[model samples]
Target chain A: MSDVSLKSMDDVYPQSAGGEVRDYFQLLKPRVMSLVVFTSFVGLMLAPGTLHPFLGFVAILAIAVGAGASGALNMWYDADIDGQMQRTAARPIPRGRVSKDEALALGVVLSCFSVLVLGLATNWLAAGLLALTIGFYLFVYTMWLKRRTPQNIVIGGAAGSFPPMIGWAAVTGSVSLESVVLFLIIFLWTPPHFWALALYRCRDYSRVGVPMLPVVKGPDSTRTHILVYSFILVAFSLAPVALGFGGVAYLIMSGLLGAGFLYLAYLVFVHRVGVEADGHAKRLFLFSIFYLFALYLVLLLEAMVPGMMVPTGFEFKV
Target chain B: MEEEDLKKRKKRSIAIGLMLVGFAILFYAITIIRLGGDVFNRPL
Candidate 1:
């Protein structure tokens, strides 16, 4: 009846496990990948030293492949829990679209290719950081902390936070305090962000025996933790402003964004699911995504436009 | 039957695309390595 063009899977044939080209792509977790690539690109841009343009591109590509590899491996290992959780139940492996062995082989291949190419293209420091990131995410986070403790996301967040540092290393062949600040911002932001999701999805995590903070500590405590981490995140957000990387525009934008973040966290903290459940936790969860993205956008903008927002007397440009 | 053929075609195309990308990256790495050690160096 409707004239809208329908893009349906009706034309496609199902494979043995219903696997498709897209199923393999899904194994890479492209949504998480966009963030990794953006942060690492910013890192490459923000570092002090110069890199050959072609080599810089090569290094970034390696980091991206490595990031995708880790994601695939995570899905491979977490397939069991993933099947139980509503949010992940339709993932390639869980949905039987891709086999575990296929995912694992793809992950290992990408991992080796990425790390070795990065070492050949750039310095080994960047390559080593990439390898460390991949290993830590797989071994330390996915295999170790995820099922064992409530602090899974808290510590495992470091694995997600390493791209900028690796990006800086890719360019300068060394790590610097500036990259550390970027790392810390993401580190402090992760707990509150993830905890908010856990607030609503606690039952799903509980059913799977995954000790997400809310399932482990209950909702009230989780709300309080969200508020607390939001505070720390606000403080960390201002660090770049003080360091000369972030200018007046960045400072003002970060300030407003941080204030908005704190307000949402407070709203989530005060509201609870009762007779009528207001979606405060969901609001906070959504806002947290916007907050991190906006902060990074402001930083990226400031870096591109040199003197537009340069602080009073301190001159900094990329 | 046509749908099945389309699916197979798609899979083959993707596999070829992935292989091409890998080969290109490999070629780039070899070129960089052969160019006198450092990426920043001016080629002789």
Candidate 2:
């Protein structure tokens, strides 16, 4: 059985020199890595203790590499669909810059290296979480959920959400409610954030048969879902303050950002399906990226700075 | 590739290699300091 499978794999890939270092790097999806690193850093900073700076850097690097590995694996699996979408058409595997087998090999190697290095340099707990992140991303999100349902991003968001918690675990070597809140913030933010993009890119998704909310349910229904998720995201953003994981800086930033996000969602939801609706959806998509980055940046700053006051009435022990 | 072109490519490759080595060393140095390593007791 093993020999048969190995023969089939070799047949599928043949032999190619396409898996150069640069091509492998392209598989990492650097933009996504940046977000992963930032959120993981915030989680580390917000954790109750300090790591040696070098160790902290190593931990973050490991997490970033793990994220990259996941991206590589995702690209390996999604190469077919990716080729069909304009936004993803130029990716290494789909463009034949790297073969699917080469991409898979790079991903597997990096995944093992990262998880092992993290376990040795940090702790088993962080290592385990990293493993879970990779597994969930590959198995639960990519393989099972991505093409199966319109609720894909909602569930798949958990894979992206793990970084902060992994960062926290790197420091504290344990899970906490605070880390979970950080996870929730990203989780709830993902649906509307992605759905907005889906609204404008609906045709691309439909062409590829990806079953995204907009493609599967029509733009009107997708608009309503975006509004619903946006409202939920706002609530989740404010929950950190109520949960005692954030300070005044975070509250004020999140409040203002949440209002902006809601307004964008409102526009996307109400605008008639035409050029105007497309423009509104695109605006929401762009702002969602900024909204998340700003939200997390404020959280990191608040955690780093001393004597930043939080709301008085808000308190949660766990 | 021509001989002159090959020479240029080799030079470019060497330069890139050197730059990568320098960056790796710098990264290691910064990481060691950040991780609270004792410079004097550095591992061989």
Candidate 3:
């Protein structure tokens, strides 16, 4: 064969440049999955009853897999919009590393596997909640609310908030007020956390037509909403203390951390129409992550060490 | 096409095989734990 013909054949049958395991792992949104795993671990550890160590490991693995499945499904559905945005354009599906059909198949298979294994390993209640979380993220948040309304993250945050409750149910076999409080803490924290990012990434959301708060409602209104949610989040973070689950350490930590969170939100609200404004929003966004993590960490520590959780001499009343 | 690409594909295949084997072993362990003493006490 001529060199020209061989070169043409090589061009037609290109060498294998395909996805690696890392690309598939990226489909799982590992950072978000890590947060889910941590919160759920706190839930499992804090519950009144004990789970066998092996079964606990299984439960957490299932929950983490369930979170990853939902993330893959979200990426599959959002690939089109993701391609249009600077932040998400590098995702596996958007970058052509993984096909949409492959992502969807992986998501569906893992969802079924995680739910079934969780039910077998732990209680059905935990499994059911895991299923609900995956469905809520895919159906309610990804398919419906995200495109339709600016309030997408507000209602959609419920999906992310369910992990600790599922973890609690894995051990206790039922939901309780403590788990609900944990759920509420995350639910309330999501808005300000996301809005801070939205304020700075306003152009990206607007270009892709995702209808984020800053895109639809304007930065001023979005700033106000962030401040309002920060207020509510700070107040609600104290619920564990009132509910008698959080100790003196939790109270002190929440108070100091909540004050810092609100201060950053206030700075975001005050600065407008400049790099300074975006800087404040970015700072709040980063601190908001730390705020939530520190709050949860303190709770987990208090649960782990009884000495750290000194009684506040406060009692719950109707 | 290239030597590097061929090596990557081989590594990926091995990783997948290991994952499947690990999953099967995990299921076996979970079943044994869940059944507790019942596995040995089963009827012959």
Select the stronger candidate by DockQ from 2 and 3. 3
Residues A1-318 of candidate 2: C-alpha lDDT, one tens digit per residue: 398875764454454444345666789999999999999999999999877777788889989999999999999888767877898988886666577887788789889978876776678999999999999999999999999999899999999999999999998999998899999889998899899888888889999889899888889898889999898899888877877767788888889999999999999989956899999999999999999999989888777777775564676754
Which residue pairs clash in candidate 1?
A: none
- Residues A1-318 of candidate 1 have per-residue lDDT tens digits of 133322211112122333677788899999888888888988888888887787888888888889999999999888767878899988888777777778898899999989988888878899999999999999999999999999999999999999988989988889888999999998899999999888888889999999999887888899889888899899878888777888888888888998999998888877787622238888888888888888888888777776765773433445
Would you list the clashing residue pairs of candidate 2? Answer: A53-B34, A53-B35, A54-B34, A54-B35
- Return the lDDT, model 1, position A81: 77
**Clash statistics: count for each candidate:** 0, 4, 0
**Ranking by TM-score, best first?**
3, 1, 2
Q: lDDT of all the models against the reference?
A: 0.84, 0.85, 0.92
Interface RMSD per candidate (angstroms): 3.6, 6.7, 1.7
For candidate 1, the docking band is acceptable
TM-score of 1: 0.87
Candidate 2 lDDT score at position A197: 89
Best by lDDT: 3
User: How many pairs of residues collide in model 2?
Assistant: 4
lDDT of 1 at A124: 89
TM-score list, all predictions: 0.87, 0.85, 0.93
